[model samples]
Target: MRKHWKSSAVSIAIATSLTLAGCSSGSGTNDKENVSSAAPSSQSSGGVSESGFPIVPEPIKLKMFTRIAPVNGPFKDMPVFQDYEKMTNIHVDFIEAPTDGFAEKKNLLFASNELPDAIYRSGLSPLEATRYGASGQLIPLEDLIEQYAPNLKALMEQYPEIRAGITTPEGHIYAIPGIVTLAAARTDKKWINKAWLDKLNLKVPETTDELYETLVAFRDQDPNDNGQKDELPMTARAGLSVVTMMSGSFGLDQQLGYNINIDNDQVQIWMGDERNKEMLMYLNKLYKEKLLDPELFSHKEADFLAKQGSGKTGFFFDQTNNNFLPIQDQYVGIAPPAGPHGDRLQAQTAPIARDFGAFAITDVNKYPEATMRWIDYFYSDEGSTLLRFGREGEHYVLKDGIPYYTDEYSTAENQPKITPYAGGGAPHIISDQVASYINPPQVQEAQKQLDPYMPKVKYGAPMFDEETAQRVNVLRNDMDKYYEEQSTKFIAGALGFDKWDEFQSTLKKMGLEELQQIYQEAYDKTK
Candidate 1:
């Protein structure tokens, strides 16, 4: 889900081969020297115990397939892993692939019976995890967690919903989940061009009416000082929907593109909702008045940036810190606009509570216990932080009771920023007992912003059942195609509310009813 985009063919081939070979061989110790030499420590690196004991030894070599690009560059080795090997006596042989090709390469590897000792940052769906685990290609992690992962177990106890989210109905955990603590900051925020607001002498809009009035002023008053009515009141790129932040304002659940929650328990096609009709009607008004970007539906990322950089857009929605902050200096994150129904809701999606990046033991692994123990260390606070942030003093520093990035790691320096410490690369790993290890000030501020609207944060029911998951996946793809086409048509003024009924009928014909039922059944099961 992190938007890392890059690809290369050679890396893909190497990664594919490594994965296939790992899966095909039932013993992990076949390449003992390669695994042992990779470790940082001498303690129990790879071989069996001298006692010839039945119990597996501590510390082992693990082969991992991951999408996390090494900090120095592509194919560069990770120092943190080296340190981990030394400290825990576990060496991990990593098969790194570019994020763009990770999913495809992983799929190929799975099909070829070449699996690594573990997978980190895998793109497996819940259904895939279930299928693989059921077929014994992937081992159940629950017993491992109970026997070896004390740190992870404690965290799960504190937040039990995470267990529910990752657990299969059969009560096995196929993957270790990555936890995201900064829920508030994760919600996309509506951002407005403060420079334009200041020029027009307008305050930040809160309610929909206020927003509309301000946007109108922005359009007519030439806030950009160009002496031309070239301002676009609001806009988003063609594929990215800006309306998700606004939908909650219209008294709809936190639905976007395909997933819609009806009456708090049922999931259905969002575009088929009556409220969607109302939303489309409003969008049509914006289009008719020329307030919306005329090319919004067809605009590429480059085009979107051009519009924003050219000072033509008055408002847009995005992750405030990650997207908007990097570009414009004069912008403020605002609460979702209030709507006619007195709703001012914001959509907050759930973060994977377990390691979204997982480590799976292969049947080929000779020292399974050693591998498990090394991975178990990952669940430990110390190990997690090390993997996520690198050696602390090098990547980050503790200053006056707060953890802050060093000058070398600061974004302001234009230095090669470390990925693990930065958002989207890896979850922050810190000592579980260390209060200072909590999120940074900016993330805390973002969370505070959402506290006022937390009561309105509603979640769609879980859709994890195998059959229901497959149906949902199929419907999701179809709905995405339909929504993209229809939304473009509506935004471009090629479609209108006059065809709204027809749109709903078309959605039903496309299996919306079956999708809804599937979701409903899943929801009931969860309850």
Candidate 2:
């Protein structure tokens, strides 16, 4: 409701652990301090009060297992957490791991049964959240949200997708998500080189046929003006992910891979569909015609960036073309072209509630209510401002109603020393208003082309019950690999569509029907 994301079908993306930051209410206090700005009368004598500071009468310490973003300092050193400790009189022993190695360490902690009190920036998949939640390793959070999470509760009521995304089929909310309402932060951008388009006197393509004609013009004519046919009309690296972005134009929803799509409230596997075959045929045409990157399936990131840097790429995709620096100015974001059926959508763009496991309480936690209270503050506007932007007067200041970083805190050298205002994904609610404050102007402008096409009701990553998860996992482990291989072959012209019926039969034999059934069951409950 806050950003109106619930009006659409928002899929929950898997997000995990991240580390500490601080919030200041002007005064700083020791981590072990028992005093708070709020008077102690409103607080409970032995537990968390209904309102106010010093959540516990006596100082309490929580052990949190989290991972630090490379930009931010240790959680123990962050003034936000320190100031928070002072306000609540709750000391936390933050056990942090490096971003690169966090996943392994997090898994080990669970495997050893030596869990901390709670997890912050915890990167749990929907399946993992459901599995651990069902097993009682991660505690249920619905009751806690009802009692101690007024801000989160209000948001959930306003935006039901937030509730839908995190709630397990069995009715457990195992994790707290990091909410981002910025449109620019959501999807991989489709950037077309407008400079090239202008050189060839072409309008920006608005349909699949127009796009093909544009690519043909780009290939046949030297739009780059180098006099040699060196331009790559459309280029991408080795992955079906590019195809995922392109599939929406073909009237398919292929967001998070596995060729999974939903149509008319029913789960439909698109891998064997004729539409998918049509999409592949189009791709194969590009590959054979030399309009696509000849090494589409083998190029590394370095080579990909190098191509864009050379400024000869007619169309390509990326989260941001910041990698292509000065040359990126030649390009502008383009919405997906309409297909034969007038289907034009961006299935990839994310919802306001992006990360499903930014924070979670484990069964080992002793003060669940206090922890819930602690995290709930972040969902509030003021609390989110503090958590992400640092202090009002010191780190950033409001000028003409928009937040701007103080000169001292804005520098690259000092920015990371203070907090990760630049790097998000922490467990906080960053509205478009606040989130836009940090984006560079170019990124902000490019997203304008994509915003309108972002789907309102696209399905997201699915969660499963224990039995379903097991069976789904078994089928996916085998089928996913086989699917990738076969699909790549199909795209490369190694496997022809004449085997389309055989591919469908093979997928059914590999239990594709059961996989769709399990997903359908989980999906129906959300509605």
Candidate 3:
């Protein structure tokens, strides 16, 4: 039997101010009260005990929504959830949206006020979370964390940066972020065809000029030995393509083309910097020489993969070489090439290493306390390990304190299905504890090559004031479109470098300064 949440249930009536209500419950039909009565009452003044996992004495169900795994299956049938339920006595109803159009579906769910009890791998932007928390759509979790989530509280204390990264400018935490610290967090890495380098008798490139020469050698020397000029010096399919990695060499870490950088402790729009102009010019030269892929701007992922698979690409960029075809053995991760200005490192991401707001509780949940407690288990060391690696003998095996994936789990073909069950590729905290145990030999080898060049930065998502945030959104849209269009033209020779001054002027006209100012203010506030 089910009952409506009682009047005494704590409600986040945010049209007014942050307030709390009392919790009172009478008898229930079952031995344990269901979610309708249990969540609201237990959420206030410590509804659930602060004890460890298997949070509730009786099993309860909570509805959750998230992006579906690449492998098609019922979310309820996921082995990870089945194990979690067995361990914690909590059942979940999962609503999975396809990755391609998840945001749209999520927004529709929100707009319709048909929210689930919780959203896993929520993909909520900081601005969206802030806006929702400020309204009553999402509840702030400070109270729950302090009173009900010892594991999460300890995590915040141990990693103060995590607290700072997730807390809104208003000093409220609206979501639980996934914290992934591992070799993979190195983020952007450049991979070169090492076999090709050997064929041409060229060393790995250490500078932008050297990289260009290497590309030229690959193009002219017939490194693939097909005797036809078919080798693509470099290729990328993502929007940033190689730009995110290359711009850093020019002393302008213009990530995703926003051009935001810290100079003299202030947010500077690096697109306005002269060094960026040189970088563009250099890229144009590569484009003119046919070293960079001619279809760099328009090529689909399958097209790029075809070239790599056919041994026609000598240089590429990705988080790992393992993602490439069988020829991946020939590719090795290389440092971003140094520019004459002497910057040669991938720009570190914001402090929250993993996707922020990966997990968030919705306002509709009456069992915020129970929900927080259940989620908190995943943040604890033991629980985090379990979620990340799965049952020891079943999914992984330990030898000399290191856990390795079982034979069934080792291959990539098995990972899509296996990892989701282990929470490997899912949105959850994968701390050093998890990484240390689960990182295979190949990953460790890649880590050694990448660690030295990965500079760590502490910028989190910018928290703009409501008015400024709206303006920045408008300006950012126009700025990104204009930047991409102009840069492509210059690289493709459709627009000459003679129009460089006009491009800079256009950026200024598009409110580049105001955009930087808004970001600067937000950055300062974070400090």
Candidate 4:
């Protein structure tokens, strides 16, 4: 769930044959020596009788295929995994790949039947998880969680919605997800240059009309005081720009590209609704008046940040107010402006969210129970603390029983270098309790903006099945490209409401009905 990209390779007959021969030669144990501090015992179960921690006595090794964040260093050298090895008496032979190259390598490994005991951070989608689970490549975890995963079981019981999200229509959980409950739900925070607003003697806009007037004032009067007329009233990058946040004001849920929602237990595409038409009209007005960024459709994140760095941007849409370094204080996070229909919802992330597929045990694994127990620790308070914060005295210091980064691990420059060395950035489950108490002061303060809108946060419905998934992926991909092209035209005044009916018809022709049907079926099954 950290800052990791996806990676892929095709299956080849030669690779599969070679893998089979290698496996048949011997059990896949590496010649690496025991470097952990745990004392080796003769008992395989280690005769240990604890509810959590130290699952077995004799060291059992597991082969794990995982992806490493660029900041997390090499998997084998991470202190967090090493400490976990000692605590669980389970030495993991991590077969890790770079984030960008993991997806391809994972498929190649699976195609070659060279699957390890389990896979971590495999980046599998819900549909892929279902397909693999049904095909027996990925083992079902309902029974395992019931027996060996006390911490995870307790978590599911506490948050039943999470359990529902992960459980497929066929009634099985094929993967374990990272529980992100802290500030995870608030996705669309609009940050304004407070310094610019103060200089212009303007109040924070409370409605869309007021926002427009403010932006117009920003354009007519140089709020930056540079007398160059260079200040952009608002700026956002190419994909999912400020439009995503503003679209919510039009009674549409446009997050995750689907823009589909379950209303009164019925599936519908919010983007296809009449309200979206009005939204686009308003955006076109802004584009015509040059209130919105001129290069918004082609600019990248770097370009947007560069504008912020040069103090040329007045309004920015983002999750945090800390993007512009050295001048971060000039920005302040604020709630989205209310719409005419009083719509003011922000898109919130699902709690049972997996970063692609963070944890899954394969059919080749011989120690399902032990592996389940090993992973369950991460969901526990003690285990999550160790995984997220690392060894207390060494990596961080405890103040009033709460962990805070020491001087060495506090700054941005050193945090990346020290985090991987201390073993804190690896993939692991962190509970809402951990996130609320452990986050730094700035993060906790920004979370206050969610108190008013958190309950109304919009969440997308669950997706399932490989066939439906594949079809939807194709349709969604084609439709997204079309939407971008059409949106640019409409905002640029090249496409107008005169062709709006034609646009709707074209969407229906592009499989809108089929997409809705697929989502409706999945939604009913989940219910």
Candidate 5:
């Protein structure tokens, strides 16, 4: 990915050199001050010229740090950045790092006092944002946003809860948030082997009773036709599968902590809830009947994938069929199986519209107006599309005014070769709407398949307060470890229901009450 950005980096460097030479030639005087003076006018709607360019005195350069996926192509010289700089008339000095190295590099940069003018997708936690904002290391964008960011301001007006969610208790927003409109497509869906269903002549299981019967048939009938009795009805990577889609079937929230709604006002821990015990009992019955995978608790993702690829498992939960079946035609996505209690639950983990991964201006920036104006352009439909898809006719083409990715840039065969195009850049630089505008046909089809199922899913709790977040983070970690350990023992028949009280005692001793209290308070604050 770094190789793909070479051209863009070279272009930026050339532009910077030309700007420097022009400055040295005395063609410009007080360039910074002049640019700064043009800032306020740009805040108004009529400040930009008909060409959609801000009426700033001269172009100003700003530094930025960002990360890209390893397969996303090279960063420094990518044509996307070059095109962005050329079009916006704002040179961006970018420090592009690979995704794996992003967190470490960002932390080092902050720790070493070598911060850039702005950070995009820095992956800083909410806690880090609060700490940095409080320390003045990061500037609150509330004033700058009001004065210079009309697009962002309008976005806030449309989603006021989002504004409140990201706003600090002191009434300042420390970071800009990524916007995602649909939340339902974010949950893990129950995928079953359609081939196996056909082999057994079984319709898709909608109820828990039907699912159990189907699993029993798969276990005994050997739907794979392998002749061996080596079939697992369902297999999951233990802790990963213990959440909402599965546990919610028993009328219990799958997620831990303050997000679990006891009533309208109360937040409680799901583990201590009686519904959880019932869920455990049901799971134990599956274990006793040999319907559950024996090695599930010990399996890694790779192990699960191996099982999936081998066609040994009948059903499992995953974010998408793409994770297990590359051939979308082969599998079926069924609604989560209903429990005995008639609860047909779905998991909702949609990306928040204003919860982080947005661009922000820094106090250290010498050209705030130029920077804000250039960034604000990204909010425009045209500008957003350009950032997301690349230059028209180069990365994409228009048909009847609907944008589509060009074959040369969108096909799997051309992906590596198309690195020079701007479509490969970080998503944080653009909006989801823009990306969807130029998405490949296959991607568009997949999204359509997933969209209708989204509304059926439910979201977890709101974000907890700082202190509560820290405590829940700690408690969840411990709780998960305990769950994993105890769950494995119970499923393997090493621990029995006779010792259920003992397990409860152990959880209480591990500070479960303290953890629950912290979450309850945070949940109240959100309300």
Candidate 6:
């Protein structure tokens, strides 16, 4: 049902450019009567309608790829999708990739030109989107958004940064971003086992030393009270995230955070700083003393969550554990403990404009207009509600104008599996209104614990030009690999502290300064 995108050779660029330019640009004078408009035609556009349920007059199937956790079963078996198909008159041939190795598989799909009609839940980096869109592996969507996606159009007008964040150097929009408007949904909170602390007669840690001592107590005191040394004092999931989650105490952030500290509008990369060295030493101390989880670098999310929920995890960090683990009220969110130098920045804060690649169309699609109209639904309030809370009467019930999951889906285990938003792969808006309903009170209170220490000015992702994007990716690819390797060794004590200076020097030699300069230039342009 698809043709090879074969994006090789110089001639392909011209052909692709012509194809992109020739598509309707929403100029009223040149409107195609046969395409997504009144007049009927044989093209897939004939099935598409202007508005309402059954996005198309007739059934049409789109092949797309997205992530799936094992617990969620097959994507097609999802209740929302099962109901949504009847509502939309659209069938999705979902190519499900397991969440763990999905990234490597996604890369292979693009590299091998085994293009799906679209990519949903696509975590496309700005570089990947730009590179592919520029080369025509992915199609430009700005014109399509203008013509077909009223919901998305309204958002771009409402949040102008959405446009700025997703637009490419050549002024093409390759992907639709998932916007997170909820304040509490943004940052990772450092969660401590309040039950453990109370059992050990300990207060929440206030300083680095206090945290160290408390962890030691957790190791020796048998806080779980089973009289067995089975408690894991601290743990992480999906490998090295413990470092990222705890990095704020040392004054850095995680994931898409890129280790930046923008103080007084001066951008700096903290990877090479001596303060980071201190943080590494502290982590090493924890490692040597067995205060940290012995499986910190190797534990999977499933294992970690099971352990956290089992009443023996003294500490962990995540956006919210109330939904993931059964020990909801047992743990309390702690603010970043004061480091030796007293820097206690929260690890991350929600930026209005977060990830840009939520959904994208590849050039092989014959139904770009239909696809745009279908995906745009999630951007609307009604569509977002469906994606988040499912059909209101069935999945949730309204009580005093607030949506609450029914008893059948109320427990942590069932809610995560049954909620329409489970797996979190949809290209939808989770507005503050949605967050108010979905983020349990415990989660809300935990987020409050983090508010005072969060950075005053939370910087969103920087939009780099194509050339700068390429260079930054090149430098970051090498430097990030080296940093993670060396840092892990530093924490595990595989690398001696004497090599610390060598690590810093290696970072500098690997274009660390130039990387900072590029980000600085991008950051400045945002101002």
- Provide the RMSD of all predictions against the true structure, rounded to 1 decimal: 7.8, 5.7, 9.3, 7.3, 10.0, 8.6
When summed lDDT is taken over every stretch of 10 residues in candidate 5, the lowest stretch is 8-17
For all predicted structures, in order, the TM-scores are: 0.79, 0.83, 0.85, 0.82, 0.74, 0.84
Compute the lDDT of residue 89 as modeled in candidate 1.
Answer: 47
User: lDDT per prediction?
Assistant: 0.56, 0.71, 0.64, 0.62, 0.55, 0.70
lDDT of 3 by residue, 255-294 (tens): 2114666665567877756877788789889989999988
Q: Which residue pairs collide in model 3, if any?
A: 39-366, 39-367, 40-366, 42-47
lDDT of model number 4 = 0.62
- Encode model 6's per-residue lDDT on 383-434: one tens digit a residue: 6666666667777887766667777766655654654356664688777656
Ranking by lDDT: 2, 6, 3, 4, 1, 5
Q: Write the per-residue lDDT of candidate 5 for residues 398-503, one digit (tens) a residue.
A: 7766556686766533443334222232223234445543333433444454454333222233344455556656766777679768866666678887888888
Error of 5 at 198 (Å): 2.8
Q: Which digits, one per residue and each the tens of the lDDT, describe model 1 over residues 408-449?
A: 655522222333333233423233222233334443454566
RMSD of 2: 5.7
Q: Compared with the true structure, what per-residue lDDT tens digits does model 2 show for residues 353-397? A: 777687888887777878887777778766676676677798889
User: 178, model 6: CA deviation in Å?
Assistant: 1.6
Runs of candidate 3 exceeding 4 Å displacement: 1-49, 254-258, 302-311, 348-350, 421-425, 436-439
- Candidate 4 has which clashing residue pairs, if any? 7-102, 7-103, 7-104, 8-103, 8-104, 9-104, 45-57, 46-57, 124-357
lDDT pick, better of 3 and 5: 3
